[model samples]
Target chain A: MKKRCWRILAVVFWLLLWQTAAMAVNQRILLVSPLETLQALFSLLQTAAFYQSVAGSLLRILAGFFAGLVLGVGLAALAKIYMPLREMLFPVMSAVKATPVASFVILALIWIPSKNLSIFMAFLMVLPLIYSNFLEGLNRADAQLLEMAKVFRMSAFNRIRGIYWPAAFPYLLTAMRLSLGMCWKAGIAAEVIAQPKNSIGSALHRAKVFFSTPELFAWTLAIILLSVTLEKCMLHLVNRLGRGLENAR
Target chain B: MRVERLCKAFEGKPVLTDCSFSFPTGETTAVLGPSGRGKTTLVKLMLGLLRPDAGTIDPEGAKTFAAVFQEDRLMEHLSARKNLRLAVSTPDQQISEALTALGLPARDETPVSQYSGGMRRRVAIARAVLADADVLILDEPFKGLDPAAREVAANFILSHCPRAVRILVTHDGAEKSLMQVKNVLDLGMAKEA
Candidate 1:
């Protein structure tokens, strides 16, 4: 209760500071008060276009995130089973990690439609992190347990769910958290560059063009809220999966 | 089963050489050896985790397909039932019975990580006994248990895996008669070069 009260007070203090700054600027185009941004956000929420933009950006970004996750895990599994495969993937994964998201977004814009740029950018940014972390976890699996599995001739499916899944769960969760945050940030950056229809980045671009400072702030706030909510939802689901693996064969 | 002139070496240091042994089906063989006598290396060879440099291991009648290794290899964050569930396709009734005989928690929710050393050892024992295999290799499966508890675990293993070819690896020779293992192979006295 005390923490909650302090958080509320902190929010109020920031809003007051914003309102004072907006009043001193005396130009709605340059600075918008927190109250003005909040009002704009609520009003924008009533529009069909606003919902469409939010939904479209979310779907593309999430599609990219899931795609990257599947490919990363698949490649990591292959690498673990074959040393030559691991050596082959090292250079490519390192390049993906080293290259900036902007270069990929620009290159992707040239290759694909504007609507698909965010998806490609997001996947590129997340793949290396997922692959590396998951591989590290698999490498740390208990050798003795693996020997046990071998003696029993455990089927490949049971070996994964029974041994590898639990051993790799924590690493996978950490990767998910990191990749999820990166995916959203890169996805939005791609959107701003591509200016795709029905996207938060395009909406942000319009706000800047029309000198609607309050609308710009409102969109930024929406991005933060959506990013946080999605991250929390994903983490909860991963933890539930971990619990199931604890007892599952 | 026959180990004909089996030889194994790690990095030029010979652990075993020209060591021949035969284990018949439906009998027990107590492998008595001191530390560094390649008993574990021998077990690993049979499990196919290691290959003998020179020798033929003809697991003619019953290959050792199930084992309690030198280390308790139970998954730490799972309960006894959960651990056994992965290693065997045994029914719940038999699993519970095996755990009961070993004096372990049959269905407790506590993960093996939190259990004491003795408890974890018993869980590993239960998993090995319950595994659906013809040959059982027990390597210090009762290491952490007291004599009283060892008796319980030994009896359970003897009774449950009666039909399987049992190979017992322990420092205690008394366990031989306890499990009715009349055959003994002392690798400590075996030749190595």
Candidate 2:
């Protein structure tokens, strides 16, 4: 409770500072007050177009995230088992990590429709992080425990559930927390560039073009809120799944 | 089970050389030696966790093996019962009885991570005993137990694995008497029992 109060106070202080700055500037195009931003957000909330944009972006980005998660886990497991595959993926994952998001956005636009750009961008941003972290976790599993499993002749499924899952869960969680934020930022950036119809990025681009500073701030705030909420929900589900695996017979 | 001219080395240092032994079924064979005398290396070779530099271990007809390692290798995130469940699908009632007999809390939901060292050791012992393997290898299984708990664990192991080819590796001489072990393979001199 005390921490929450401090957080609220800190936010209010920043808002007051922003309001004072806007008043001193005396130019609506240059800066907007916190009140104006909130008002714009409220107005946006009342429109059906706002809902469609949010829903469309949310579905596409989440589809990309889930697809990346499955492929990342699968690829990591295969890499762990097969040395040639690990060697083959080393340069690919490194290239994905090193390349700038904007460069990928530009290159991808030529090959795919603008409607699918955000999904592709989000998936690309997420895959390498999940793969590397989960593989590291698998590498760190207790060797003694694995030997015990072998001597006991445990089935492959039981060995994975009992040994591998527990070791890899924390790494998987870390990857999810990081990639969730990255995917959102990159996905929205793609949307803005690609100008997908009925997307939050398109709305943000329109707000920018019209010099509607308040609307731009409101959309940015909405994206932050949505990203944080999605991250929290995903982490909760993963933690529950980890607990179930630990206690399973 | 018999080992024929077994030899093992680590980085050109011989740990065991030309060692041979036949472990009888339905009896306890204690592999007694001091520290750094290849007691663990011998067991690991038998469990197929390590490859011998030479010779072979024939299981005869023993199909399955279980072990209590030097460290308590129980899943730290699982309860004692759940750890046993990973090895065998024994019913809950029997699992609880085995845990209770070993002086662990049978119904407790606490993960083994929160257990005491002695409690964790007992959990490891219980896992091996309940694994129902034809060959049971115990490497210092009673390391962390109190005298009373050690006695209980010994009795539980003896009672549970009557027909197994029991191979015990330990430094404590008292465990031999407690488990009523008759066949002794003293590795310090590399001599046959």
Candidate 3:
């Protein structure tokens, strides 16, 4: 507890130094003080548009993440069982991995509306990472345990729950953590370029155009907060899943 | 059970060449040999886990299988009972009795990872015996058990599986005696070896 307090204090001290630097500069366009950013953030909180933007972006990005997760795991399982499927996906996986997120977003702009482009961008960023991680995990599964299961004639469901899940869990969790962060970053970047209405990205764009440094900092802080919160929640969920599996055994 | 004209080689080095044996049915036959004498490889052949270079493992009427490998092939996350349940459709009471007979009263709910070497061996034995298998293949099943614990665990096996064709592969000659086996196949002294 004391350590946590000291860490918090250290963060506060650094933040205060930032605030002092901004105040010494006395240039609102250049750097906004922490207090000014907080005030802007509080003001934005009162508007229904802020809430709607948060909800819309959160839902769309989360949808893409979940879709990618399902497809990635499913395809990986198939590929692990059949080498031909893995061979077929080689070029596609390489293309997805090599393509730039911004390029994909711009290219998608021609096919999709500005409102839904963030979802595609988030999905594109997340799918390959997850698929590759799951595939690696599957590849590295304990060969000895699989032999035991085979000799015992273990049912497919039991084999997955007992052998596959435990083996793949840590890798899957790491993949999920990486993909979640990427989705948020790429999703917001897409929104900024597309300039979707009522989004934090759009608000940040407007603030930049008008030189509202405090507003820009406030929107940035909001994104950071949302990202941190989402990460914490997902980690909590994965931990719970691990505990549930442990208890199940 | 018979394996005729069995021959296996790895990278041009023959391991078991022109080997043949008639394994007894509905009885325990302990195959004793030193390390690297194809004991484990033989078990793999019988179970079809590894394809023999040249041979057929004719089980005759065997359909299902249960094996305790040289390594304790346990799902570390699951309880012993769950592991047994995964193998067999045995009722809860039968599983409880089987575990108790093996001196594993608390094992039904305990994860196999927390078990000691002897306890894990017992669990592996219990799983193989209790599972729905026509034949039981035990590869160094008592590799880590102390003398007393081995006796108790062996007794559990001798009592539970009376009619199943049991093939015990081990380095211990004492283990063969404990199982009351009449035949001991020394793979190291096989004609081809």
Which of the numbered candidates is closest to the native, going by highest DockQ?
2
The CAPRI-style docking tier of model 3 reads medium
- Ordering by TM-score: 2, 3, 1
Q: What is candidate 1's DockQ?
A: 0.68
* Predicted candidate 2, C-alpha RMSD: 1.8
lDDT of 2 by residue, B72-171 (tens): 9888877777788887767889899999998789999888999999999999998898888899999999998999999999999999999999999988
Predicted model with the maximum TM-score: 2
Two-chain DockQ for each candidate model: 0.68, 0.81, 0.73
| Candidate 3 local Cα displacement, residue A104, angstroms | 1.1
**DockQ of candidate 2 relative to the true structure:** 0.81
Question: What is candidate 1's lDDT per residue for B1-193, written digit by digit as tens?
Answer: 7799999999999998888999867788989888988899888888789999999888886744899887888877777887887778889999888887888877787888898999888888888878857888988777888889888888888877778878888888667777788688899877532
Assess the local accuracy of residue B123 in candidate 1 as a C-alpha lDDT between 0 and 100: 84
Give the Cα lDDT of each candidate: 0.86, 0.91, 0.84
Estimated TM-score for each candidate: 0.91, 0.96, 0.95
Rank by lDDT, descending? Answer: 2, 1, 3
Identify the superior model by lDDT, candidate 1 or candidate 2.
2
Residue-wise lDDT of candidate 3 within B19-54, one digit each (tens)? 688777768888877777788778888888878888
